[model samples]
Target: MSATEQPVHDHSTAALDHGRRGSLGQIVSWCLWDFGSNAYNTVILSFVFSVYVTTAAAPDEQTGQQVFANMQTVAGIIVALLAPVIGVWADRVRRRRLMLSVSTLLVVASVSMCWFVLPYETHHGLKYLYLGAGLIALANMMQQVAEIFYNSMLVDISTPSNVGRISGAAWGLGYLGGVITLAATLALFVLDGGFLGVPEQDAMNYRAIAVFCAGWLLVMSVPVMIWGPPAPPAKGDARTLNVVSAYAQVFRHLRRKFRTSPQVLGFLVASAVYRDGLSAVFAFAGVIAATSYGMDTTEIIIFGLAANFAAALGAWVFGLVDDRVGPRFVILASLATMVVFGGLILAISATAMFWIGGLGISSLVGPVQSASRTLLTRVIEPGEENEMFGLYNTVGRAASWIAPGLIGIFTALLGTRLGLLGIVLTLLGGLILFWFVRIEGVTHNRSRVTSAA
Candidate 1:
């Protein structure tokens, strides 16, 4: 292969696939992991635990926002520092699943501990504030790291003919899980006084939900461990390396990619910019609804359900289209839709905006995210999959602070509603760069070659 071209490496052998077509049970198991993992996404970050930490636990509104942003900033920094190194290590050791399992266990443990983050009037310390936010931060980092490993498994269960559908199915499962889990939260916690008559005092209602979210993740996340494609030994060249060597290897890998496969570099940078924006959109969705759109807790929960449903449907439908028309189109279209919807939401300030524009914006979120993953898989080879996915998470998290950081800065200067413009800007950046990307090697020939082989 020439520089700027990807070599066709056999992906069939890695990440639980054992070089065979994956079974339905295995596919479902893999997707279910997304389902379970999203418990952390929906409950802790987007809606319940974070809302509790910021609004209920913090001293004031501004401090709450600052604290939430800072917590994520620190977590992003930690993830950025560790993701590539750990990914390098996992690839070397051929222990991606072990790494994922341990990371997931940490998420469960940390989320459950959020139960103790009782409100201020009931308990008198910044201890809960720090503790809750800290756990949320840790969980955020751990979950992200886990996803790097999880994402590597995509090739294990996919074929070029069906990769889009497989990825879309998994993405759909994630949103569907959020839909079901969030609805369960509404049924179990938000509607009633919550389990065991947990007093609304001290934010106990939210505290109980934290415990529930942990349990939810625990149950949803375990199936993949049991049923995912059996991980084979890492590629023959996969050698164990120390941390220093691991990073060295990563540097060499990046150097090779930048020179020989500039497309990879371009995709990485573009993905980093837009994915940060995508993360921010979901991260602050509930808050925006509550504050800007005047969505009550009940309404926010309902909106989350509607948004998840829309996202799940969009991902599934667009995924099939992704296979035929290509992920590039899907991504561009999704970004364009998001830019338009996000701008409209910024300009308009009413419940109608959230209901229409908010849902429209949420619909685009999944296709962009799912297509992004699918696009990356279409670009890279096998042995380096784990490392690349790690870099994916690394670069993404490296800039993770950007959207939230910009939002924090702008919100402080202007106002909450205006701060949302940051997301639009980041998306625009990614969309612009994405336009130049040319998928030369993998997308056109890999499927035919793999089928022939």
Candidate 2:
């Protein structure tokens, strides 16, 4: 193979069928992990706990929001600094499954600790609020790191031809899982003081939900751990490198990629910008719904359900299209659609308008995310998957602050409605930059090879 070409390694062998479709059991087992992860994504971060942290935990709404933002920024910085090193370590150790398991356990612990974050009106409320935010930060950092190891396992479970579908299936399953868990929490806890009779005092209902989420995550994670394929054997001695030296190796790897695989570099930069925009869209969706459209907590939960359902459907449907038309097309189309819908949300203030635009924008988010991963998997050099995925996480975290920062600035200067302008602009920026990226040829070649084989 040329320097630019990927080599098939023994790591590819763990899956029952290498260079072909994985077994249904393996695929389902792998996808189940994504399903279980929604406990964190949907309940803890996106819908319930974060909202509580802002509305109940802090001394006031603005202070709480600022504190939350600050903690996320801190988490992003840490992830950016450490993702590459962790990726290098995972690649060297060749134990992505074990690393993922350990990282996931850490996340579960952080999430469960959310129970201790009490309301500001309670004794030591402010102190606990800060503590809660710290735990969230820790959870976010660990979650992002876990994703690097998780994503690297994609190659072991799929072939070049079906990668798009498998990726979409995972993302779709995650959204679906989020919806179910969020609904369960709503039915069992958040609604009518919860059927479980958990006291509403001190927001214990919410705390109980956090514990439930941890257990849900732990349960769902079991299938993958039990049945998912193991990492392929390492090529040589297994010597762990320190963080500083790992970073040095990362720089050298980057240089090599720039020369031999510019597509990977280009996609990384473009995806970073767009992915940040996508995250910002969801991150601020609740706030915008509550403040601008006058949505209450229940209304926000209903809206979240709708958005997650739409995203799940979109991911599954577009995944098949991705394999045929190429991931590049799917990404470009999704980005363009999101940009337009985001503008629609900014333009109209009616609740109906928010629903329409919000769901439209959300529907495309999963497709964009799934396709981006598929595209990267198509182009990356084999055996270096973990490291490259780490860079993916690094670049993403490096730019994570853009949308939030822009939204804050715009909201301060213009108005709450105009804050969405920041998200739209970020998406537009990514769309424009990604337009110049040339990965169609890579996908085309891979398809041909797969077909011939």
lDDT per residue (tens digit) for residues 1-453 in model 2: 799776432211222234645578888988888898978988888888998898788888888878887888888888899999999888888888888898989999999999988888876447877888888889888988888878887877888668889999999999999999999999999899888989999899999998999998888888777777777777786789898889998999999877656766887898999999999877889889888888899999999999999999999999999888877788888888888887777777677888998999999999999999877776666567788899999988888877888998999999997899889988988888888876534534545544554
Candidate 2 Cα deviation (angstroms), residue 378: 1.0
What's the count of clashing pairs in each model shown? 4, 1
User: Would you give me the overall lDDT of model 1?
Assistant: 0.80
What residue runs in model 2 are displaced by over 4 Å at the alpha carbon?
A: 1-21, 443-453
Query: Where does the lowest 10-residue lDDT sum fall in candidate 2?
Result: 8-17
Q: Please give each candidate's TM-score.
A: 0.91, 0.94
- Highest lDDT scorer: 2
What's model 2's lDDT at 297? 92
What TM-score does candidate 2 reach?
0.94
Q: What is the number of residue pairs that collide in model 2? A: 1
Looking at model 2, the pairs that clash are 11-232
